[model samples]
Target: MNTNTIEREIAIEAPVERVWSLITQAEHLGTWFGDAGANIDLRPGGALEVRWDGHTLIGTVDAVEPTSRFTFRWHQLDTPAGADLTEQNSTLVEFTLTSEGDTTHVRLVESGFGSLALPAEQQVAMHADHSGGWPVELGHLKDHAAVVAA
Candidate 1:
């Protein structure tokens, strides 16, 4: 079985531009994502940080395609907040967007669980945690969009 990736899709009532802003902008990310705060540089090679419950997750932008796609490499769940992200210690997250009339489609993908250097049990647990977490985060994003776009 392929347990290396988690994928989620959500349709938002906001335009593509607004959805893109909500995901890429630090202000919106913190609200829909980390409870403490989030900050992003929003360009390839830029830094992304999300803080929640005293734990920080650091990421580096891997690609930026404006309102269409944003990709980043994030530290694994068990890794220390500020540790350097390596292939064995991080996973790839990609966000893709498409505009549909008055709404926007957001597709999220996080991969690399099978290749992580962590123990097999740890890898399985991380995959399960993320599989469940992404949906909630996307829901927050959709709700946040309604509030922001109103």
Candidate 2:
């Protein structure tokens, strides 16, 4: 497996339309995304910051595919203790949502960190860390969407 890639997939109990709307809308994002350093401009070329606890995750939106997909350039602005990560740009995030009957399939891919601002070792480590981390984040999305749909 390529450590430089961050991929996560989850199935939500909401319809494709509902899931799409929740994920794409800035207001809905702020509601369920729990402010995890998350700041959504909701437009192309806008900024995104995902914060949890006290740390911050920063990124820029690269593209938005209406109700289908979204792409962004992602970086870790601060470490666990709010320490700045010297190696930035080791990440990029893309989200794809598909509707299948009453279920929505969400796929998240974050890559491009292999050649970012981080040292080679740290970059690889970050990639590995994100590999599992993304799924957990998606789980949050899944639960949030489920509740809203109900």
Candidate 3:
């Protein structure tokens, strides 16, 4: 892999505190991001596991800075078949919340793509997969927050 990273950002029409609460809440996550029953322990070094449908994603909380920033380490099962594959990846997903007056800028910066347990080609493909995935997730987050704020 070329050690390249994928990043996506979205401006939410909500305050930093509102955005932060949505991301940290496991029940809200399930309603918008993953399976409806997913559970999250929002503490550093805690378990972050989500069992969505038949796919399971398990990770650990790496960093948490109140309603400002949070990072995690993840391992996901399953992907688009024949695109690329890795059993585990020591990747970093960071959520940075910055407020401009009333709106909050939510930036999702995911790095360490080359640390995945797969061939260089596969790692690159996985990066591509996430490159698209994060935007959709953020869109969902934005809409969810807007509804809650309303």
lDDT accuracy of residue 31 in candidate 2 = 58
**TM-score list, all predictions:** 0.93, 0.80, 0.85
- lDDT, candidate 1, 83-148, per-residue tens: 777889899999999999879999999999988998888888989999999999999999899889
Best by TM-score: 1
Candidate 2 lDDT over residue span 1-150, tens digit each = 686677778888888778877776665665555454357787887876665667555666778888689877755544444333232533567889888888888888877767666677887787787776777667778877867745
TM-score of 2: 0.80
The lDDT for every candidate, in the order shown, is 0.90, 0.70, 0.76
Q: How far is each candidate from the true structure, as Cα RMSD in Å?
A: 1.7, 4.2, 5.0
Off by over 4 Å in 2: 31-37, 77-90
- Model 3 agreement with the true structure over 1-91: per-residue lDDT tens digits: 3445777889988888888888878877775677555677888887776666676666778899998998887764344532322325467
Displacement of the residue 16 alpha carbon in candidate 2, Å:
1.8
Using TM-score, rank the candidates from best to worst. 1, 3, 2
